[model samples]
Target: MRRALTWVVMVAVGIFAAVGLWSAAVDPAPVSAEETAREVSQSLRCPTCAGESIADSSAMLSDAMRQTVDQQVRQGRSADEIRAWFAERYGDQVLLAPPRSGYGWVLWVAPLALVGAAAVVVLLVGGTSTRRRWWAALLVLAVTSLAGVWLLVPQTTPDPQRLKQEDPPQVNAVAVLRDAVDHAPGNAGLRIAFAGALEEVGQDAEAVEAYAAATRLRPLDSDVRYRHAFALVRSDDPGAAREVLEESLHVRQDHAPSLLLLGALVHGEDPDRASALLQQFVQLAPEHPAVDQVTAFLAGQLDEVPAEALP
Candidate 1:
């Protein structure tokens, strides 16, 4: 019994050591959509809120980025692919970790090369007798092989409790927000947040309804109404969007977005009115970047309202 207990303890220690080595080489594998989204978000820097990953940020842009990550994860996008997507859109600074390819690869290779050289020197210097050298070399080879296998091979725990701990129950952020909205049916902020999250994932129709509810709750908020119109346009309800934009302009005519979107919405049906709204938008917001686009629109182009035209 004593010998068996010793053997069991030795095996357990070896298993844990192997796990430590493997974990040092790579991150824990994400086993569910929520985990995958979290892992991806944690690896990317939040553009609006630096120093915090999107996973930890409460910034609006971070929320959108997280939703995008979740959608892509559900679509089976690989982590590298999702990282590349963010890099392409937001530039390389968005990645918390630099790419392992290209010139940066030297950074990764150098440490490993140094460690290998150190191992070689230790083996040569530590071995004095031929018999000792043989044993040392054998031990080194065994250790290196074991490490290589541990790093390369995928591991799954057979214990149910460990598996439960490793992969907690997946939670859907959207579903959670939806439940919050259901519980607080009059909470316009929850409605708007849930709507924005839906819009981030391309659920335009549902976002339109959510934004519409927000608009009704906060009719005086020009920004809320603008979002409602924008969501309406995305859902192919341009007629209703035009009416909402018109209503927003009636309340706040200085609203550049309402003028800009209404101009485009009416360009085909009412050219003269479209030109007037476009011309007014340029005069009211001359320093705005969209002014140049509006100028082109006045000249002959019908500019599509870019997303988030208000702010």
Candidate 2:
């Protein structure tokens, strides 16, 4: 028994060494292309994180975003075009810096103006009586504090009615999407958009319903199905999420998002299936931001990772 155990260990070590050698032989991605991808990624916030740039985040969504950036960069897309694509997918908040044209100039210039104004007030009051100088200081402090609060503190809940009344609710706000769905109830795309808007507003249950309706309208669309699965997961319906993801995989076996999500959902209950799916995910998306996360998870769970899944 001891000799057999020793032989098995030897074989495993040999296999791993061979796999390592093969993985090392493969060339890495181009350095310039990676640097360009990083530049664009740094400009975009991770959709699933608070103020975290996608380039600097470890979340799976950020990984996917980075992968998109890398692919667009490799395709020779211009920086503005890449940014525009991200904005369309995730909205303008994805861009760290707001546009400077139009009234947006107010957002950029107001703080500087407030500071400069306060400085001038202080200079003017420098030679005044102590009481008068103190009054001027108080006034300046109040104005600066209010300006800071206005620019820094995000509103907890946006007024949907006010946004709805705006000429262009940027097309994806809850009220506008709700109106869009009302006007075109049968449109699968509209349903998906409304569902996304609902998701953004913490209406996960309603989002699930909308996503379900979208899947009913476009049954073979793997994208819609996977998105529905995501909503179901967010709604705390893991069983249904698994079902929807499996259905999506049935439609398109190589769908990476579906594979990644389903693998995570089933990781504890059906580890073998999860491992297979995760292996496929890594195979399909080797450059994903969460590759390290997935790799670490896999190493922790398994006694020995398969050679193909190693690098």
Candidate 3:
């Protein structure tokens, strides 16, 4: 019986080690926009909605928040950077995920420590053979259950409401951009710069307007048109985006960025055309940073290529 129990423990340990090794060896699937948005939102509270995560809320503000998360994720920002962006705008209260510092560490550590201590105490206690068997069984069950839960369950930190708060320092990029735009109102370059700053700050609608202005000032510039179309897509006007991208292609037939963006915009509604455009883009810009993602996407390995990977 003792040998049998030892073998059972060894099997469990081997299974756990194999799982750990497999997880370490396998590359995580690229995160899709919706999944990335949902994951970020799960860590954030809806600023305009009460008692709900941004992921769970349908309020317009929550929608904007989700878009910001999606944009940041596509831009390859880390989760901490995205959280910091929200915290800058809405205070630390915007985060549902508790900081891992201070007392927060205790909440995570104490439970597992208690389980370990309990098991140790059970093994150390002097008892009858039946009692020893019972204790051993309980210990095994407890350890197995806890290990399963730790591996399978997504662990959320304690509620942010209960933790101490610190406000993030703010940078008023919009005001700086506005000042620069005012100084050179006719400069298409300045306007594009302003638009990019606005997009970074989660002001998608304003970014679209700024991009439109830049495109108007440089109507013959295919690059400006591509930027405008990309901004339009981010603002959820894919039809208009398509028209602008087509105009860009008319201006410069080999404009790789426009082709790539257009492909992504139409990927859902017209996959054949999208695939052709993406293939053309790959041929035109083989050395571009987005090529790997596009290749992965074309090969059915990824759901979508991130926007930041584009020029």
Candidate 4:
């Protein structure tokens, strides 16, 4: 039993040591749709926003654009192919995603070169026994070979149309917005759709125009006004955003997202107002994640305030 326990402990320690070393040596590669979208969005302008990208946008159109990207990725198109297709359609403005050819070749080769250089330095300094050195080289070579095979192997072809069909946009918001604008030639609905898509993709300024158009067309629509206010806030025009939100609330009280966003906006500049609004939000939505986060954040701020400001 003693001998067995000793061996078990030794094995555990070895595993822990190996894992620590492996983790220390390997930098994780980014590989999620969100990460890819962020990377791509940074490079491309939002079609609707003056200078926003789809990755940062909150409008419905931006969501559609991202959905399109997700569909292409699913259909076995390389990231490069997908970006290139957009570039062709919208010109260089569409290529929010990184290029992989020519100057972009550095993105592909730099990581490998860095790893190789580090490994060589480690080997030279570590001074492993001959047998260990040979084994390490062989293992590294095997890993490299496997990676090459994976990258070079032909992928299974998929039908692009079918992939898109599988994931239809929630609102067809992108097309409907475009068509409305084209057909009506100053239609507020169409403008709203266009602006919304731009905002969703991170073009705050463009979204504001659409929201403004929508407000002009339907002065009674508090939702449009609320959206406009948020767009202004997102664009760092807080004074205008507050005015819009106030107008929206006057038209229709008890708006949820607007209220929450208002609370968030006021939190830093006017803690008293922020605290009151956030407290209301917390009471209204105790179970919501946003509520929880806001409550905790507000509590922290309260804790930081001077004794004189507590009241």
Candidate 5:
């Protein structure tokens, strides 16, 4: 029995040492841009499709989303930051990963709890004849538990100084726009510029307000109305966007952007009208960057396009 236990100890120590050496010798391979884009896209729902990841969808909107992920990855943004950016534009439903707050903790904790309970049961119910084997199993379990704890624990605390160094303060673009609008209260161009800047910064609600002001100031301006409608769509008010786009169409019947945006906004609820609008957009803007996407939508071939064909 002494000889058997000594052999077991030697084997266990040898295994641990081998594992350590292997880990120390191995370096993780760097992920490629396409690989990073795919990984990030897998975590995001396609903005224009139901029940599909952006990585899996071929719609133009999904293609745009994947490109956004690729750009963010290339810029060295964390996965969490990319997810947050999408959530800001598309809402929390866009994320496949559950939020860390609330019931999300349950999913993270349950697996470790089960492993620990299994370890305890093995310790309590094993027979004496298998004592050595059980001891070895327990030793393995202890190592696994330590590893799990290390992985699950938060690795770093937020340092205010480090954060300041990493992200130097950016000028408040919206605030500057607001000041410009104040100085030129009656300038419709100033209001439209302010709205565009707000939209770029993910202030969709404020952007809608600024766009509305510009639209009211220049009700006959097809471009201003089209921009206002686009802002409304971004702000999650698609119905209002449709109304504004219809009015813009009344002002300029061949406005391609308004037709395209309106078609996208109403596709789910009014496919026939959406198709007509998309067809009109294609006819009016045959050389536009989005023409291929609109043509695919009209032909019902968007779902058949491969993701690689997008960008």
Candidate 6:
């Protein structure tokens, strides 16, 4: 029996060793602290999400902002200067992730506090057996180690999307929208304008949220709804676009633009059904652009007829 127990222990040790090796092989090598900090900050919207910085956005404007960051970094600009550049352009709104001051301190402290509380709880539970307490201590140690590692790790990689959310190195139209959002938190028009700016610059995700907020504030406005749906489509989130289009249709039937988009979407997925919708579209507006092209395309599927029968 002793020999059998010894064999089981050996097997367990071998399994653990293999797992450790596998994990090491699969885990990526640690990045520089600076790169890690950059990635974490990137893609994080400014507090309102409408005031997204280049680091937090994937827009064309954000791309330009990122290029500026790279140029500045290469030119030996200080971290403070780089951050200040964005702060100057978009004001405080361009910061991706909150600044590490004021309310921002809360974000940094919450995780650490949770871990510390857990460790304290484990220590206070003295009624547990010695072996159980040891295991608890080990768990707390692992958590503490991970927290420490997170603190030490630098953000190194720069995300272009985050450039929009991060402070811009310069002032521009997006800055205007940011200012507007700051002054009028409850204004739907201001939100929509910011969303458009985001889309114009290629920050689709932030634009999506901004558009959503605009629509929520003015659900009766088809213009806002259409823009919201269009933004969703631009972001390549067709599922959301379709749903919004349907909602818009429910509110106002025979909306030609919505019909056109839905018809295209439906047709892309199922040609036969789309063809029927195209016919309906023709009946609704014969002189619409691309009408002849669509009709000719549909004609290919029908039985051939002589020119004399043509409309």
The top-ranked prediction according to TM-score is: 1
Q: Cα deviation in Å at residue 179, candidate 2?
A: 1.7
**Model 3 per-residue lDDT tens digits across residues 85-203:** 76665566666754444555675556667877887777788387667676766677557655754564444644545432433223344653565465456867768877987898889
lDDT on C-alpha atoms for all candidate structures: 0.70, 0.69, 0.73, 0.60, 0.67, 0.62
Cα distance off (Å), candidate 1, residue 266: 0.1
Q: Over 4 Å off in model 4, which ranges? A: 1-176, 185-188, 301-311
lDDT of 4 by residue, 1-311 (tens): 44544554565555556555554456333377656555544554456554456676675556455656655655666556666766665555444333456665575567666657655665776565664465445445544643453344322223433433343223334453554364454556557768877777787887887788889888778778888887887788988988887777677667655666676666678888878776776777667557646766776844432312211
Candidate 6 minimal-lDDT segment of 10 residues: 302-311
TM-score between model 3 and native? 0.43
Residue ranges of candidate 6 with Cα displaced over 4 Å: 1-171, 301-311
The alpha-carbon lDDT assigned to residue 239 of candidate 5 equals 89
Query: Poorest 10 consecutive residues of model 2 by lDDT?
Result: 163-172
RMSD of each: 12.9, 26.2, 18.9, 18.6, 15.7, 18.5
Q: What's the residue-level lDDT of 265 in candidate 6?
A: 67
Per-residue lDDT of 122-194 in model 5, one digit per residue for the tens?
6677667578366646655455644444344432223434433342222344554465476456767767777
TM-score: model 6 vs. ground truth: 0.41
lDDT of 2 by residue, 1-311 (tens): 44544554565555556545544455232358777787677777655555556787886446555656766776788767888876765567667666454555787677768776776767676665665455455555555454444444422222434433434212235654564465456878778877877888899999999999999999999999999998887788999999999999999999888888888888778899998998899899989776767777788854433323322
On lDDT, the candidate that comes out on top is 3
TM-score-based ranking: 1, 2, 3, 5, 6, 4
Name the lDDT value of residue 141 in candidate 4.
51
Q: How many residue pairs clash per model?
A: 0, 1, 0, 13, 0, 42
**For each candidate, what TM-score against the reference?**
0.46, 0.43, 0.43, 0.40, 0.43, 0.41
Better of 3 and 5 by lDDT: 3
